[model samples]
Target: MTNAPSSLTSAEPVTLSEDEAAQLAEELKQQLRQGQRLAGDTQAIERMVAGLGDKRGLLRLTFAESLGTVGSAAVPALCQAMCDHDNVTVRRAAAKTLTLISDKQALPHLLKALLNDDDPVVQGSAVGAMAVIGADAVDGLLNIIVDPNNTPMQTGLASWGLAFVGARAPQALRDAAKSENALIRTAAIAALGDQIQNQGDEEARQLLLGALKDPDEEVRSEATTLMGKLNDSGWAMPLLIPNLQDSSPLVRKNAALALMKLDDPSAIPELESCMSSEQDASLIPIFRLAINQLGQER
Candidate 1:
């Protein structure tokens, strides 16, 4: 007479206590190290996904790493668990495991979780996975940012994903900069700042220059903020100086801040001039600060 195999070998979901989960995690790691593959083992994969809900944080991380090693073969089960699982802990873990896998095919499922998951941590984990997937995730992320139907939190997550992808895939941001929708253009401009700072992308610099004159106030304001944050006063100073007279007070104020970051003494004359002519009471303090700061830098 033979004893029945453990439930882990069965197709049904199995729950493990902390000690059992720790032992299983070690066994899986050993098997992975010995060149054993779990590629088509649906039973084992499902069990691992369920293990993601283990109460021990370290054990949950172990399960996620083990599942990540399973690679694309693990994506389907992980996606289902992330989207449909009853336990929020399992859903969050599944999304994070997909981030380690970083497979493009998981984008759709990750996007679904990011937009529909009631748990903010799960949504955040889903976006984090999309960001790790890199260039392939750009369009979906940008679409979410421009979609008026999505909530502000959703759009904010998408913006963060774009910034993460920007330096690695700058061409996508350049293409997005020409979008007819000002929202898309503004988001694209904001992401491109990362490209400029990281890669010193000349084309990105040019796009920022054109954005400074954009018809949309938001676009101009975003571009101005990028200029201040760039920390390259030589190039940014000339472009930002004219923006001090922009029709929008926000843009004018941002221009002052960017000039201060440039830290160049030559900008003092320009800052003083803008202050003398400035009419907005709220802006007067900003202009005065920029002039004083630039003077001290000399």
Candidate 2:
């Protein structure tokens, strides 16, 4: 049905005079206050969250971010913008900021953005913010990795981001080390050290130990690098001792490097063993580096 000129399409050229627009803006400010307080008034912010579905994408995003900035009372309305809002990027940004305004409750909405957002940029932003949100986000992000149905790449991304968040994601770190995918394993171990490097505690030590023992050479190697980083001085002997004997030459090589950082002579025998066993084999220069490092320790 063709509409008449009186019908206002969202794309219609806005023709308000400057004074009129200024007056309306002031009116909206007052309405924003009243709506926030009374709940009875369907104020300008209300109208905006409602209008988010409007065909004009830019206006919709601007309105959502504006409403999100309005504080706690604005959450119920702005949350709809998290998903119901049209532009994926805008929806993601709104979800990210809303966590700041109110709704510590918005954690769930943010998690949905992690797996469901089709845009990787959007997904990545959600991850950046999820790191801000902390431990609560761990379960969902881990689910993406451990659940095969969740698709490996997506799961890998979630694990990787959670790692950046550090020890807060211990359970996820522990699980990712078990993944068969070498990429997933490498990412998980790297994140393990990273997570521990930030929030490490006794539990983190346990998780890193598991990573140190992972069958994949890369995972074991990264785990050895992380050994030097564990917050507890006690972690040095427990982890470095076992890693010195890892089957992969790279693992043994990295273990030697870590042992040097601790200056722990206990690993001298193990490092010497690795040097003799490899004899300039698969690990080549790294093996030699380990031997030279062991010499200094002795």
**Residue pairs in collision within model 1:** none
Please provide TM-scores, in order, for all candidate models, with all chains considered together.
0.89, 0.57
Model 1: per-residue lDDT, tens digit, 157-181? 9998888887767888898888898
Question: What lDDT does candidate 1 reach at residue 256?
Answer: 94
TM-score of 1: 0.89
Q: List runs of model 1 lying over 4 Å from the truth.
A: 1-14, 32-40
Model 2 misplaced stretches (Cα beyond 4 Å):
1-43, 46-73, 76-79, 102-104, 149-153, 164-200, 206-225, 231-238, 248-272, 289-298
- Location of the lowest summed lDDT over 10 successive residues in candidate 2: 1-10
In model 1, how large is the Cα lDDT of residue 10?
25
Q: What do the candidate models score in CA lDDT, each in turn?
A: 0.85, 0.59
Find the candidate with the highest TM-score and give its number: 1
Task: Tell me the tens digit of each residue's lDDT in model 2 across 1-298.
Answer: 1111221123322233444444544555565556643232336555545444444554545445556556666654445455445556446655655655644465566556656667776666666656656666665565566566665657767766677666655676566666777656666667766555555455655756777777667777877887776644465766676766666667776776777776665656676665676644656566566557657757
